[model samples]
Target chain A: MKIAIDAMGGDHAPEEIVKGVEMARDRYPELEFMLFGTESEVKPLIQSMDRLELIPTTEVIAMGDEPVKAMKEKQDSSLVQAANAVKEGKADALFSAGNTGALLSSAIFIVGRIRGVERPALATAFPAFGGPHREFVFMDLGANAENKPSHLYQYGILGTFYAESVMGISNPRVRLLNNGGEEDKGDDVHKAAHQLMKNTDAFNFLGNVEAREIMEGTADVVVADGFSGNATLKAIEGTALTMMGQIKEAIKGSGIRGILGALMLKPALKAMKHKMDFQENGGAVVLGVKAPVVKTHGSAKANAVANSMGQIQTMVEGKLVDKTAEFIKENADKLKVKKAAK
Target chain B: MKIAIDAMGGDHAPEEIVKGVEMARDRYPELEFMLFGTESEVKPLIQSMDRLELIPTTEVIAMGDEPVKAMKEKQDSSLVQAANAVKEGKADALFSAGNTGALLSSAIFIVGRIRGVERPALATAFPAFGGPHREFVFMDLGANAENKPSHLYQYGILGTFYAESVMGISNPRVRLLNNGGEEDKGDDVHKAAHQLMKNTDAFNFLGNVEAREIMEGTADVVVADGFSGNATLKAIEGTALTMMGQIKEAIKGSGIRGILGALMLKPALKAMKHKMDFQENGGAVVLGVKAPVVKTHGSAKANAVANSMGQIQTMVEGKLVDKTAEFIKENADKLKVKKAAK
Candidate 1:
């Protein structure tokens, strides 16, 4: 199977994307890559290879450009072109480290979404505690804001499918993220979703889980509206960064004694930092689409880019799309009630 | 000044609380502490100190009991008796490392609110990079759920007062805690609060601050509704703990190479861990009240209890209650707008 890579995306684009493609090609010699960008920009980065194919495109989308507007006006842009490659079946999947909104909009508008899906969601895997720990999937991380209760229920269904497909966890435990772990502690939307999840047999409803429980290995699939999920994710990221910076200053501030103590604790500290790193999870996948689309971090390095490519391969080879299709078809009536209510 | 201590509160109550009182008496020679609990529980622990007063009580609030129910029925409970001391003018203030919800209710319903106060908020100092570095004061940590726009504005005002009064910062900058740094990223409540803050002459309204900015020393006061603030705070704590655990495992997972790298990075890691520890922030202060009420952590040790007592002294000596009263009186018209809207 071939996957299209947005060569003009990311800070270290063209080079890192090319390196990632080469790494993937080395591992799976039968795998083909369709690199999209201007020949002049792509030539210096692409080493001579038979399987690596460069699809020439003159336009490129700047990182700061507005997504919806750029997608509408810049038809010839590399992001749009790469997406078109997936649409035309030239590649089975599309990967970009460009503007997240633009990549999502391009995938939905250009390649299109599944028939019954109302809105596509951006899904990410969170590492749980313990060995061979199963990852929990959450939808609409930042894709759709101001979600209705039905949207949240749909997210639960989609997230369950994604978890079962990728993590290979059968009958995954599904939970609604709330302020308090109690069922009655959330706002109106959360209360509505709580009832829906309880009534539906589409998922393994585990009841309300607090933000703290997310990291404590409470559920296999956590669901929420984009605003809360995105806010929670950003808050976690911010706190991790803030704590790291504080730890650095504090150890140094202790002068000699503090520095000595810090010296003794160094090994455990590095291990801690790596666990908090976002790169370890690869990147977020845009779910509910006709084909796989992975949106890596905009500032992703070579290793991050390589991991994202591997994620694409995992999704494609794991038949995640087919599993999602099957799940949707089997649970069509519940989804119908959900859609009607919306 | 005399302060009532709930000797029956917290995980290590009676024992730790007694030790903390002894430490406080030794530290502040002129200060007096009234230990509220059954005489049987307090007699064996501390019966010699001249400054240590014992106020006997019989009931106890279990850890799992609902706050309102506990407050209403456990009339002679240690937590209630402590609050009664504050209400009857026997003690200058009350301190408890107990059920936070129960403490909050007793303070509001029993001790009563300050005149003209619409709602009382819980404010906690989050240690920044280093050297105090302008600790962030967040309000309504868990007092009220489903907060309105006006409630957020009031939080900004009260939070600013706490920062300036307790932390000794002049004209503390106040920011709304939002999902993103952008002005337009929050929910309807945030948008409304944003407009109110800009127009009202009550604070030095800095715009919307993302979750990461809380630890980056961007604002002295980060205000939000209780639900979001509580969730965000807990999520941060959970992530830090998880990261610390993972880091330790990673260092031990591999062989000598990992051990050598871990050894080399010991000091740096220790420094990082120390910074994320929130216990250094003392306890969360209940702002916009008639008296200085400090809520210690449920798991607070002797040092944390001491920190809470120290905070009370700082506020009382500075006469922050009078200063905050003046500030509120001066901005009475603006505050009335909030009261009317709510």
Candidate 2:
């Protein structure tokens, strides 16, 4: 399989991106990379890696650039070129640690969406507790902020497919992210979406799951609109960071004993940190699209980029995009018929 | 000053409820309590304490009961009676560690909304980092599941007053809770709300605030619709719990050195726990109401209940209801005039 890499993006750009490609090449000998970036910067970093092919691009999309405009105008930019490679069938997947919006725009406009899909959602993987599953899928993580009930229902279907195909979960219990677990909870959109999802036999529906119960691993796929999902995702991230900061302060204030305790608890603390780290989780995938497109954090280093490559490889090997397209094509007519009947 | 107590509410009921009242009475000698519950269950717990009056009632609202229906039918229930006491001017405020929905129902139906207030919001305090202010107030924490742009604008006004008066923060910076900090972020409702808030001089509007910046003390007041706010609030709570659970597992898996390290770091961990504890932050306050009504957690023990009482006492002493009424009355005409001009 071949993966397209946007090397002129993220904090550690060309250097880390090239290093990551090298690492992935060493690990997965069957996999190849088409690195897109300025030749001068990316060429030195390649270091005679045989499996890697440099696709030189002149322009670079800055982190703060407007997404749609940048994608449209910066045709020669690494991000756009990388996405185009997937569009032209030169690469199986597109990977980037660039400006999220720009990457999303490129993925949607360049890599394209699956047939019969209204909107593609960005799916984030969050670590879960009290279940055999290590993590669950949360979708629309900021793709389409304003979503109709139909959009949300589609997210459930897309999330279900992604969970089953990519995450290797069978049946992948899907639940609507809501204020309360009860059937009669949430706003009008949620209520309508819940009913639609409940009536469908496309996946395992587990009713509405509250945000407090989400981390408890109550469901494998939690679907929500982009707005609520983004807020909830950030809230979880912020709370974890705040708690860790508070713990650090506590350790600092405890004098000599605290310093010794820190040394003894280093391994445990490291383990906990690793568990909470986004780098370990690879990156968020843009589902409902024609091809696999992963967006890692802009600050992601070599290891995280390598993990993202591995994740993309898995998605490609598992034929997630093809499966999603087939599912949507098969069920789109049935869903419309059901809606008309209702 | 007098406060009404729902003695038969919460998991602990009369035992912890009466104990909390006693603790509050001892701490604030100027305050008196009107405990509402069955005399058989509450009288023994009261222990003939001075300034404590047991108002006997027969009915009890279960935790799982429908809020509106329970409040209407269970008129003689402790939750209903306590709210009635505040409405009747027999108590300065009402405090409960009960079914949150029931308490909110009673607060709205019995105690009533302040003039010009369309909906009463539930405001929760979250701890902040690296600031003189230890916490900030987040509003509409699950009061109205479906909120219009106007409702969110009103929340800003209500949240501003609650923060300044009750939280004792003068000229508190108010922000709209959105998917991103950018002005163009969020759904349609948020965009309209942002425009409304920006046009107003009633509060120190700080534009949009993302969920990730909430715990970092970026703003003094974060206003969101009930759906997003509740999801964000629960996400924070769940993340904290999950992290603590993970830490426990880590310590257990780390052998004797880790156990000894835990002992040495016990005080620091305890301090960190206290900071994150809901009891330390008191409880969510029902804002835009005629009286200060606070709802503690359902499983609240004596200390949490006591903290909630103290919070209510502070609200009553600061005349939060009167101030809110004044602010609304003063700004209502101006807001209308501005709307007409627009």
Candidate 3:
């Protein structure tokens, strides 16, 4: 399997990107990487070229450029070129730690969407409490700020497929993220989406899941409109960070005894930190597209980038994108019939 | 001043409610309490009748009862009666730990909305990072699930007054909560609200606040449509609870060394826990109402209830509601002119 990497992106950029490729190539001998970037900038960063191929590109898309405009204008940029490689069937998947919007735009416009899909969603795994599974898939994490009930329903279907095929969950329990767990909860959009999800047998519908229940591992797939999803995601991230910071301050302010306690509690704290680290989840995936496209955080270093590569390899090997396309194709006629009835 | 208390509400009910009233009465010698509940259930719990008066009522609103219906049908209930006391000017303020929706309904219907206020909002203080002022107020927590741009603007006004008078922040930095801090970010509704806030001189309108910046002590009041506000609030609460649970598990699984470290770190943990506790912030206030009506957590104990009473006392003494009404009266013509222009 081959993966296309956007080398001139993220905080560390080509250096960490190349190191990550080398690490993945060493671990998975059958996998190959195509690095896209300016030759002079990326050449010195590559330690070994055993299973790696450099696809030189002249332009670079800056982090702050508008997504759609940048994707259209920077045709020769690394992000665009990397996405194009997947579009031309040169690679099975595409990976980037670039501007999220730009990567998503390239995925949708360049690589294209599944035939029956109206909009593509970005899915990230949120760490869950005590269960056989460590996390659950939460989708539409800011791909579209506004979504119709139909779009939300489609997210449920896409999220279910991604959870089952990529995350290896069987008959993945899918749920609509609502204000309350009751059937009559949420606004008109969520209410309509809930009913639609309930009538479908495509996945195990678990009804409404509230924000408080999200981290409790109540469902394998939690679907929401991008606005609420993005807000909830950021809230969790912010709270966790603030609490951790406060805890550190508290410990430090506790005098000499606190220092000794910290030393003894280092192992436990380390374990907790690892559990809270989102990088361990291997980043978010832009689902409903024709090919697998993964995006790591812009600040992601070698370990996170390598983990993202491994995640992409798994998606490719499991044929998750192909499965999604087949599922959408099978449902096309049913969806059309439903729409006609409506 | 007299404060009306719903003595038969919350998980602990009459016992904790009466206990909290006694605590408050002792702390504030000049203040009186009007306990609304069945005399049989509440009289036995009161420590002294010095400044306490039990107002007997037979009906009780359960936690699961629908809000508006319960408010209308259960007029004799403790929650309703407590709110009615404020409405009739028999009490300066009202406090309850009952069903939040029912309390809000009663506050709006019985106590009434301030003139020119479109909707009443639930505002709660979220713990902020290291500052002399420990928390910031987040409004429209779940009062109105859907809000117009006008309602959001009104929240900014209400939140500002509450922050200044009750929270003791001078010219508090108020912000509109959006997905991003960019000027043109968020959906159409938020964008319009941003423009409205930007044009207003009623409050200290900071451009925009993202969820990640909420806990960083960046703003004194963060305004959001109820949907996003509630989601963000619950996400923060859920993350804190989940992280605390995980940390406990981590310590337990680490053996004797971890156990000793935990013992040594007890004080630090206690301090951190206190900082994260929502009860420390004195519960949520029902803003835009004629009277100051505060809703404590449904499972609140004596400490939380007493803290809520203290909060209500502060509001009444500071005349926050009256100040809000005055602000609305002063701006009534300006708003009318703006609406006419629209």
Between prediction 1 and prediction 3, which has the larger TM-score?
3
lDDT of 1 at B247: 63
| TM-scores, one per candidate | 0.89, 0.97, 0.98
- Model 3: colliding residue pairs: none
List runs of model 1 lying over 4 Å from the truth: A52-59, A87-90, A131-134, A138-140, A242-272, A278-281, A336-342, B115-117, B130-134, B250-272, B336-342
Worst 10 residues of 3 chain B by lDDT: B333-342
* Cα distance off (Å), candidate 2, residue A267: 0.6
Candidate 2 TM-score versus the reference? 0.97
Candidate 2 residues lying further than 4 Å off, grouped into runs, are A338-342, B337-342
Please name the candidate that would achieve the greatest DockQ relative to the true structure. Answer: 2
Error of 2 at A229 (Å): 0.8
Candidate 3, B48-137: lDDT as tens digits: 899889999999999898889999999899989989899989998889898888999988989999999988999998777844576788
**What digit string (tens of lDDT, one per residue) describes model 2 on residues A163-278?**
88778998898999999988889988888888888888877898998888898988999998898999999999988888888888999999988878877887898889888885
Q: Which digits, one per residue and each the tens of the lDDT, describe model 1 over residues B1-342?
A: 888889998988888888887877777765789899878987799947688888889998766678889999999999999998899999888888888888999888988877666778888888665334546787777787677888788777788778887888888888888766566666777777787777777889988877656777778888877767777787778878877777667667755655665565566667566556666547888887777888888888887787678888887777766777787887788788766655
Against the hidden true structure, what lDDT does model 3 obtain? 0.87
Q: What is the lDDT of residue B231 in candidate 1?
A: 72
Q: Report lDDT (Cα) of residue A287, candidate 1.
A: 85
Q: Name the regions of candidate 3 deviating beyond 4 angstroms.
A: A337-342, B130-132, B337-342
